[model samples]
Target: MKNLVFNKLEPGTNIPYELLLLADETVEAINQYIFDCAVYLLNDGLQNIAVMALHPNSNTELEIKNIAVIESYRSQGIGSILMGKAKEIAKENSCTILTVGTSDTGFQQIRFYEKNGFVKKGIRKDFFTDNYPFPIYENGLQMRDMIILSHDLSE
Candidate 1:
């Protein structure tokens, strides 16, 4: 698990970045609840650029609970690389599906996932209502629905 290029992120700041990226829990809850996660860094060790959360799924798929790239790191292909590592790990573990969920308002994330060949499989409306401290909006739209995306790793 540690063989991949992984780094350590400051707990509070990093968790909020995860929340902003996916509307997850606060930094505190994330620090306490979601313990199985990883961070990606540049080879130069300049930035803790990305985050990923790994956990067992109800089905055979492996859930990428969270993935994020800092704003300065966006548009540079770092997120894709991080996801590629996650997909590789999933395949190595004999998992057939790479699954993730994001708010409908996360337009950039939706585009990123779609660009990476993940398909929109389902939605859970109001998935973030009680989970986040404040309402989240993006691209002039409020994020109330959670969209589930999946990529078939077996293919």
Candidate 2:
């Protein structure tokens, strides 16, 4: 990851909709929170390799609304680095908890979050079906619920 830079996306700049859409399903869903969240990009000097969008849910809680590493960069520990950066940002903002939600069908994602110190907290039943306009599937399973996970920053 030499020459990689992690920085906040400048205000008034065009949003990286394609990158963000990797984690989120639709532009409308991203637009709902993108403006309210702080978006960060991980650039490898020449191009962007990852993105994370965080929102301050409360004074003590920070939520990761979206996070994605370019497909070619998967399994290279880049996602973990982004998770670490998310924790740092959460702590810097006086947050005690860092939370993220993913589709229950995303088995790899669930394991990834757990490996990063986040524990299963709760689930929003039918979250995908309720929020998304179309069906979402992963690993041949329909995505119906959102599995919420949390990492205690105070730890």
Candidate 3:
């Protein structure tokens, strides 16, 4: 993490597609909300290692639309740093809640979010099946629903 820098990219700036694809399933899905979201890049003075995108979901809620760290950088606290930045942004915007959603099959992701102080809020049943043109699988299990989680920024 030497020379770590977190930079917020200008809206509509071209993003690192490969880095974003590490978290999202498809290009279409990534494009769906990216243009409207605030994109952030984490670099180690060499190359981009992680990305996070966030957008307002409502007057009081900010949603983490995408978050991904380079595969080699996982478990090194980069994701936690991104989550912490997201919370800071949410609070700065006077948002009361910060939300994120992941594939139901993302076991590690669920645990990661929980460890970051997010709590289960609800489920979007058949979200993947309804939105994605193809099936998505994680950890050998097919993805169907979306598990929505939220953190209380007001706290």
Task: Give one digit per residue, the lDDT tens place, for model 2 in 25-109.
Answer: 8899999999999999999988899999999999999999999999988999999999999999998999999999999999999
* TM-score, every prediction: 0.77, 0.98, 0.97
lDDT by residue (61-114, candidate 3, tens digit) is 999999999988899999999999999999889999999999999999999999
For each candidate, what is the lDDT?
Answer: 0.70, 0.95, 0.93
The order of the candidates by lDDT, greatest first, is 2, 3, 1
Candidate 3, number of clashes = 0
Question: Tell me, what's the RMSD of every candidate?
Answer: 4.7, 0.7, 0.9
List model 1 lDDT by residue over 36-154, tens digit each.
65433433265355667666674467888767666766787877887888888788778899988888888888999999989999998797775666876677887788999999988
Candidate 2 residue 152 C-alpha distance from true site, Å: 0.5
Tell me how candidate 2 scores on lDDT.
0.95
lDDT of 2 at 117: 98
Model 1 clashing residue pairs (backbone): none
| 15 Cα displacement, candidate 3 (Å) | 1.9
Task: Report how far residue 149 has shifted in candidate 3, in Å.
Answer: 0.2
Q: Which stretches of candidate 2 lie over 4 Å from their true place?
A: none
Better of 1 and 3 by TM-score: 3
> Residue 80, candidate 1: how far off, in angstroms?
0.7
TM-score of 3: 0.97
